[model samples]
Target: MPDPTPETSAGRSLLLVLHDVAPHTWPDYQPFVEAVDALGNIPITWLVVPDFHKRDSLAFAPGLRSMLDRRLQRGDELVLHGYYHADDSPPPRSVRDYFMRRIYTHEGEFYSLDQGVALERLHAGITLFQRFDWPLAGFVAPAWLMSEGTRQALRSLPLKYTSDPQYLYQLPQFTPISAPGLVCSARSAWRRGLSRLACELQAARLSQAPVIRLGLHPVDMRHGFTRRYWMCTLQQLLAQGRTPMTKSAWLSTRQAG
Candidate 1:
């Protein structure tokens, strides 16, 4: 990892990570949660999935509710990750298939959603969070993949921020922390896993930006290779000169003038 590019700004440096806390991804979620808890008192913004993996409106799992409650009790706040953390498209062609073929194809294709659809999803997420009386903050695009229209839709919302690695500012646009290189690619799963972990650690070491966003998928947590990478990355972050922060902490440090 390289040193963070020195800056004159007085804002707080943050690790803006999102956990894909969805079903079938719990194997990874468990370890990720443990890693987060071990950080101890750091301000983390969680993009929660209260309805688990279902694409429709439903209640949360009893145990998941308890886990969320515990996290809130410890000071982490919620960001509406996504309704089901999947595209609202219909079956015969699953969301995962769509993501792998379209979003993950490396051609830079985007999943654009209109303002009306975006707002509907946001409202649904807000309703879930409000049930726990949780104050929803900003939005993080599912899988860090957003279309131009999605970006526009987010900017039109009342939310203060949205994250992406391509942008450098921290307002309607977000300060990005990109992995050193493309970690996951259309390759053998083993190779992709190894590369992704390597990129994450390399990114952690090389981050000179005031803030960096690390996105997680539940699938990564479940797989052994990715899980190993996850643990190693956490350890590396703990070892590095990095600090954890919530959206408010970062926002508070911005120049007021």
Candidate 2:
């Protein structure tokens, strides 16, 4: 296959990434995979948590590993999510921090980590992926939140990229890819409604962009509201000539140009 030319309209990339992927979340993710498969053998990215919340580790999940292996064989990409998808930071110092840490996001594993801690967690997550020999090219923090220290640590790693809610950063130099992600919120009825609306707006807004990102979560798959919404969103974007590709693949083409 020829490499995509990012400068052209035909090369606008659609990055559909599954978050919080682990053995414990496998069942929740099945519907999502099936839905995407319904659209043909479209490629997707799996943001895998090596040990979610420090409890559900991939080591004990042979079944999930088998499933992931098949996904990779079919062209899906695996990315290292935070080591322990749970946040271990101390109490927030202000109201703004509290809302971001405990309300807006339940857990931002890399949100407060300095370089030393971030590197340690990154190494631990990489070790788990290596144990299974899963090829990992990217690292995305849970909740799309990472500190400057985490960015500093990632610079020294061999990772291809990392992302926040608003941008995908190429590793080492951290070159910014300007595309805010579309994510679902199952926290409440209002949040869900608002999220769907925001998704539509973001999708339309990015119609001419070089890249468009859709971040799917376990909770989003379990609910019918978000599940159907995303499937339709996928259809709409595909109709607009969006070529779904893994984040690493997108970067490859971007650099190839």
Candidate 3:
């Protein structure tokens, strides 16, 4: 008979969350939604749109408000990804931009802005999500970039959590937890392509945490090569009987743990 243990249970279940809902490109999300619905054990947090159309070309669908209503009624959580889902106005003028700006940058250039500015920007985002009657479980910076100010601002806010690959914990206060192991990128290199999938699978196999999060993007699924690789990663996790959880659920579990 198998031993009934908490770690065993934790290893069997993990969270798989999605980001960027009702983004400027809804067409890009259809395949992702279809594949996820088919996958069946996952939950997604529809990070709602704020204002960007008036300021830029990016905006959410006109019908997105209703669609979000349905998802929330069906028991999905909403998070405030960002106001414009972009960095602040009069964008940074340097090889190294601030943390929030770096969120969308391909290269990780380290720079930071004051905490007060960070708080005000975050407040704007929070107010936007409130308009739709969506309770934000946490704030995920556009590209997971965060700085000292960002962290301090979040701690001062009323949010329940904040998630980044680097920091996994509950909000108002962050408590670091062991990741168990690293999650490799399938597209890191030609050699990494073949081996990264195997590496992630092995990590899942040995994990003691209740949920394993693999942050993914719709853009990744849009690419043929990346799509195939991600599908395999999902399959490997599913094979281990790991359940995909939304961002809120995943963070909640860690906090409780």
Q: Which 10-residue span in candidate 1 carries the lowest summed lDDT?
A: 177-186
TM-scores for all candidates: the values are 0.71, 0.92, 0.74
lDDT of candidate 2 over 160-257, digit per residue (tens): 88878877777788777665678888768898999998888877777778878888889887788988998888888888877899888887877777
Task: Give a tens-digit lDDT track for model 1, residues 1-257.
Answer: 23422354553254545465544455557766776677676666676764554642336355666666777777776676656666554322667756664666422222455666766766777677777677766676665566656666666666666555443234354444222222333145866656786676657565665555455555565566766665666556556666766655555555342
Please give the distance, in angstroms, between residue 132's alpha carbon in candidate 2 and its true position after superposition: 0.8
For model 2 the local lDDT of residue 180 reads 61
Q: What is the lDDT, from 0 to 100, of the residue 70 in candidate 3?
A: 70
Tell me the lDDT of candidate 1: 0.57
What local lDDT score does residue 73 receive in model 3, on the 0 to 100 scale? 74
Give the number of colliding residue pairs in candidate 1.
Answer: 5
Q: lDDT of each structure?
A: 0.57, 0.84, 0.59
Candidate 3 whole-model C-alpha lDDT, 0 to 1: 0.59
- State which candidate has the highest TM-score: 2
Higher lDDT: candidate 1 or 3? 3
List the RMSD of every prediction in angstroms. Answer: 5.8, 3.8, 6.0
What stretches of model 3 exceed 4 Å from their correct place? 1-11, 52-60, 89-111, 179-209, 254-257
User: How well does candidate 2 match the true structure, expressed as C-alpha RMSD?
Assistant: 3.8
Better of 2 and 3 by lDDT: 2
